[model samples]
Target chain A: MKAAVIGIGLIGGSMALALKEKGLIEKAIGVDNNVTHTTKALELGLVDDINSLEQAVQESDLVILAVPVHAISGLLPRVLDLVDRQVVMDVGSTKAAMLEVIASHPKRSRFVASHPMWGTEYSGPEAAVKDAFAGRATVICNREESDKDAVTLVEDLYTTLGMHLVYMDAAAHDVHVAYVSHISHITSFALANTVLEKEREEDAIFELASAGFASTVRLAKSNPETWASIFMENRENVLDVLNEHISQLRKFKACLEKENIEYLAELMANANKIKRILK
Target chain B: MKAAVIGIGLIGGSMALALKEKGLIEKAIGVDNNVTHTTKALELGLVDDINSLEQAVQESDLVILAVPVHAISGLLPRVLDLVDRQVVMDVGSTKAAMLEVIASHPKRSRFVASHPMWGTEYSGPEAAVKDAFAGRATVICNREESDKDAVTLVEDLYTTLGMHLVYMDAAAHDVHVAYVSHISHITSFALANTVLEKEREEDAIFELASAGFASTVRLAKSNPETWASIFMENRENVLDVLNEHISQLRKFKACLEKENIEYLAELMANANKIKRILK
Candidate 1:
């Protein structure tokens, strides 16, 4: 199978490499708006060739949208217009907005909505890595909307890359990701801001930052444009989770202010329950 | 040098292994109020033997108070009373309260207030691992209060373990950790609670949890008792930072509520500045 990966950045470049390496695709074509990304993707051998979006879609058997949520929303319908029977898929963070935009499209059955639950803080073609999706869960949203062949092909592709698939509605995917992924990015971004603001007055604080602080704040280094697009795309759900997170933080503040040691201990003990799920 | 490590838990047990592996200590003495911990510490070879506090302090040439901050506050003066010329140091999260407790003791010069900025979410003797402190920063606080030899011994010990040392004032160390360490744990705990609370209603939310969620919430698995003690001991500093963190989070919330994508992107861009410090 031949595949065209749009955007040709981290996720796109990585998918192109993985598909070709695993023999899932005979040739991988890159379609990106960024000239530098296209050049780098080819130099890095992530793709066999670079093509215009319409040309790539017309020539390839598969079209994978791997751009920020907002860009995916704008590009999916246009790509669908240019597709024949090609299996189209997206590897975006939020699903609802993109899926909603294409819900009434004639070639909707050719597009599969997926979010492989994997990424690093880095971005762009330079950040693409092999085996990026291995051992991670990938969510396939509204599978019934996609053609059986298209869905199966996308599922098989993810499975080939060592990703376990979870099926859900696009709306549900957005909500769950709001709780699990979007809010985490917000917390980390806010934490980085908190520490940075503090560090301006007290320069020595960052020296004491250990693995704990680094792990919790590393997401702060993620691309701002990508995340802001995600937050806006999944606005209501992100807001809901952010509000809950703020309330949760307020409880900790209350515990400290009132010196409620027992309650504070109880809160932390309750949090320890995450061990059951995380491990 | 003979070394006694009290509290035989994560920090103490790991310290014992690193010191022994580095040849900084010929024999490691274990001292803990928890009989199970002492037994496990000895079984794991984290120490040569389990001994009473008096025996451990009296027999060893160096003493490490690796218990939680609450226990250290209570044990420091008692440990000092038992010591003659042995260099005593602590590996607790907070330093101000611990140091203040022993500020007027006749044997004050024999004690060093130090916090090794390294730990895992797991705890106890069994969780201890070798080379845990290597390549991390270790802060020695209020070094001028300690005897020159005592300070030198602690510095040499951390250096031998392949850790770089940062000298800090005890009060400053407490405040700094509030920003770098304590606030991260609080954010993680609260995030865990937020998700757990949401999961109670939405069962499938956790299925979509990814590495970003795991990294940000991992510290929620930390021991409740240990963290509670640290929070209460450094309540004022933690509260201050927590307040700042909450306000910072509010900025993200406001951006989402107001649909201010530009400001949202700006906030995350500012957060990316952490890359400069963290890397």
Candidate 2:
């Protein structure tokens, strides 16, 4: 099957590379508004060819929306209008808004909403890497709403990429991602801003940043355009989690202010419980 | 040189392994209040022998205090009292408090204030690994206060372990770590708490937690005793940076609440500057 990937940046480029590497598609067609990205995607061999959106959609059996969430919200409806029998899927971070926008569309059953739970802090076509989605989870949101053929193809795509599948509704997917993904970016971004704002000694930070600091703040380097769109699209859930995060931070502040060493230990011990889940 | 590593946990056990592997020490003597640790350290071949603190100090040419920050603050003075010709040092997280307690000790010149900027989330003797400190920075605070020969010996020790040395005053080191290290732990612990408190679905978190979430929250699994002592000892500096971090996060919350997409993008762009320092 031929697959057309829109907005050929990190996710799109990697998806194209994976599908091609696994021989899941006969040809990978690229579509990106950024001429630079399209050129880089071609140079990097992430896509077999570049084509116009209309042409790519018309020629391919599969259409993958791999744009930022904001762009997906605006682009999905138009893509659906252009779709006939081709199965459509999106690899966007936020699912609720994307699914909500096309809830009433005539071709709603043609689209599968998915979030493959893998990414690097880096972006753009240059950041595309082979085997990027292996051994990770891919959330298939509102799978029952989509046509069986559409959902099956998307599942096969992720499975071929070596990902395990989890099914949930779009709203639930949004809320879960707010906790697991969106809040992480906010904390990392805020952490970088905090150090950049108050530390002032860039050389010291460069020399002294241990693996701990590097790991915690690495996501701060994520594409601003991509993350801003994600946070905004999932505004309510993101805000709710952000507020909880701030309050959680406040508890540490209070413990420090009161010199409540026991309470502080308790808080950290509670956090240690995450070991059971993560490790 | 013969070396005695007190505590015999993560930092101490790792130090023993590196010094032995590099042949920096002719023999490594382990001293720990916990017998299980001493037994484990010996079994892991991290040390040649286990001895009482007094016996170890008397026999070894160098002593390393690698206990919790609170323990180090009290233990440093006593360890200094035992020093005759031996050079003493610490690998604790906080510096100012540890240095202050022994500011007027008779053997003050014999003690080197040092922090090896490396660690993993796990702890104890089993956590020890060879060649752990390579390619990391080891801070030597208030080098001038240490005797010339003592400083040289400590510096050579870290160098043999494949670590580059950075020098700063104890106060500056404490403040810098508050920004780079301490606050990262706080954020991680708090983030873990936030998710645990709000997200009742542990399965969702376990399934959906991606590399981003894992990197940001991995430090949450750090030892509670180790971190609580570090935070309490460096309370003021930690509080200052924690306040700054909270304010930075508030900017993101504000942007989301106000639907200020441009400002949100601007904030993330600023955070992306960390890429320059970290990468």
Query: If scored against the real structure, what TM-score would every candidate get?
Result: 0.97, 0.99
Residue pairs with backbone overlap in model 1: none
Best by DockQ: 2
lDDT of 2 by residue, A1-279 (tens): 999999999999999999989999989999999999999999999998999999999999999999999999899999999999999999999988878889999999999999999999999999999989999999999988999989989999899899999999989999999999999999999999999998788999988999999999999999999999999999999999999999999999999999999999999999999998999
Tens-place lDDT per residue, model 1, B1-279, is 999899999999999999989888999999998999988998899999888999999999999999989989899999999999899999999988888788899999999888999999999999999889989899998888889999989898888888899988988888899999999999999999999988764446556778899999999999999999999999999998998898999999889889999999999999999998887
Runs with alpha carbons beyond 4 Å of true place in candidate 2: none
Model 2 earns a TM-score of 0.99
Model 1 RMSD, rounded to 1 decimal: 1.5
Query: Each prediction's Cα lDDT score?
Result: 0.91, 0.94
Candidate 1 segments exceeding 4 Å error:
A201-203, B201-206
User: Per-residue error at A16 for model 2, in Å?
Assistant: 0.8
Give the candidate number with the greatest TM-score. 2
